[model samples]
Target: MKPIELMRAEAVNLTEDPDEVCGYWRGHLVWVKQEDADGLWYVRVNHPDGGYLYDGFWRAHRDCTAADAVAEAFRGAELLEDE
Candidate 1:
């Protein structure tokens, strides 16, 4: 998607699972999961262009909300565009 299109795109959830959630935001894939041990959220963002921000791995958001995690992924996507 074009940068402008991406910037305007809203996140779309792909699953209804309670423990895990997957969505797409501005052409980036975002996955958020709650850890069974600590109940913290794990967020991962994957861009189609493949950037250093995510590298196809999950990052602990540590007490962050699902919306915050999604926002974080969108921020990562924006940063990747700056590169």
Candidate 2:
């Protein structure tokens, strides 16, 4: 498999770039990488207030379901005006 970094770059070139996608994360449409990197995935949430959070890819995931859960949780959060 290709490195996650390279994979992300390739995704950007695709018509529907999954890496460059925005999903629900804490009441906001956040940009996230919905795939594993180095045997793990992340929950890098983008805050609508111009700030963001990404903690060492600690929120590891062995499948997309986990990542989708994050999105679900975010969707459940109260929608923000800015988002």
Name the best candidate (by TM-score): 1
Superposed model 1: Cα runs more than 4 Å off: 1-9, 16-18, 55-64, 75-83
| Model 1 agreement with the true structure over 1-83: per-residue lDDT tens digits | 53223433555656535556576665666676666545465656676575434533335445654555555555654545455
Give the poorly placed runs of model 2, Cα more than 4 Å off: 1-27, 34-39, 53-58, 66-69, 72-83
Clashing residue pairs for model 1: none
Per-residue alpha-carbon lDDT of model 2 for 1-83, expressed as tens digits?
Answer: 22233223433322224433444433433444545543344444445575554323434344544435344324433233235
Clashes of each: 0, 0
Q: Once all C-alphas are superposed, what RMSD does model 2 give against the true structure?
A: 9.7
TM-scores for every predicted model: 0.49, 0.34
